[model samples]
Target: MIFAVVGPSGAGKDTLLSGALAARPDLRLVRRVITRPTKAGGEDFEGVTEAEFQTRLAQGAFALTWDAHGLRYAIPHDQINGPQDVVFNGSRAALPEAVRVFPDLRVIVVTAPDAVLAARLAARGRETVSDIATRLSRAAFTLPDGIAATTVVNDSTAAEGISRLLAALQPVRA
Candidate 1:
């Protein structure tokens, strides 16, 4: 099964995903292809120029694709198949498309209080004051109807958040 992990900015989705992967050796993590610079840093992703991204899209190289924050993101078709359970960071805006493409996909939605969300984004130092405000404006993003999702709130220590994420992922593996 493939898991689409999604959350608003500052929800610590990437951090929790990393910790879960570290603790669960049997799980597979699929890195994404994105149109942002590789060094922009938050999660592990392949950064390509818009031209290269378009080329790949035209070649039908992606199993799932979406646009967010003015950037294009994709999951390569070759990476989702295997014996082990696979998880990829995904966007909520494209969950409907994701459901259509990977019908059995499980969604893990990470969330945090608005205050926590605001603090984390400011701490990242990657976004300007205006940008952080823009992100916090959408902190209450909800999943589209018809999709069942397990929600994990990460307002505590990273360890606690990881534990919660692992618990959510384990039942699906069974």
Candidate 2:
């Protein structure tokens, strides 16, 4: 089973994912390859330069790739096509392609209110007020039609959010 964990920025996708991975050791988390440097530091990703990313893409090292925020993101071929119940932080813009690639892929959508999102994004300090404003504006984006997605509203405490996430992913235990 492949579960694509997706959400708007500051929805606590990483925090919840980290907690879920720690709680469920059997799940495989795909560490993405990004065009950003490792020091950019949000998620644990394989930071590569744009040239290297293009080269790897040309070499068919990825099963999936997408560009967002002016950066390239990829999921290694072996990582997705392999036999394992995998999970990864995925993007909304890439979900349609991802669905085509992994037909059985499940979409887990994590989300929160605008006020909560604003607060969290502010706390991160990675974005300026204007940048966060833009993010919040785009946060209301709707998922592609016909995609079966499970929405988990991560509006409360971390423990509550993790519990909700764990419940949503419980079928993976099978």
TM values, all candidates: 0.95, 0.95
Q: Stretches of candidate 2 above 4 Å error?
A: 81-83, 172-174
Candidate 1: Cα lDDT at 99 = 98
Q: Over the stretch 35-107, how does candidate 2's per-residue lDDT look in tens digits?
A: 9999988889999999999899999899899999999999998776566679989999999999999998999
Alpha carbon lDDT at 45, candidate 2:
96
What is the C-alpha local distance difference test score of candidate 1? 0.92
Question: Per-residue lDDT for 41-76 in model 1, tens only?
Answer: 878889999999999999999998999988999999
Model 2 lDDT-worst window of ten: 77-86
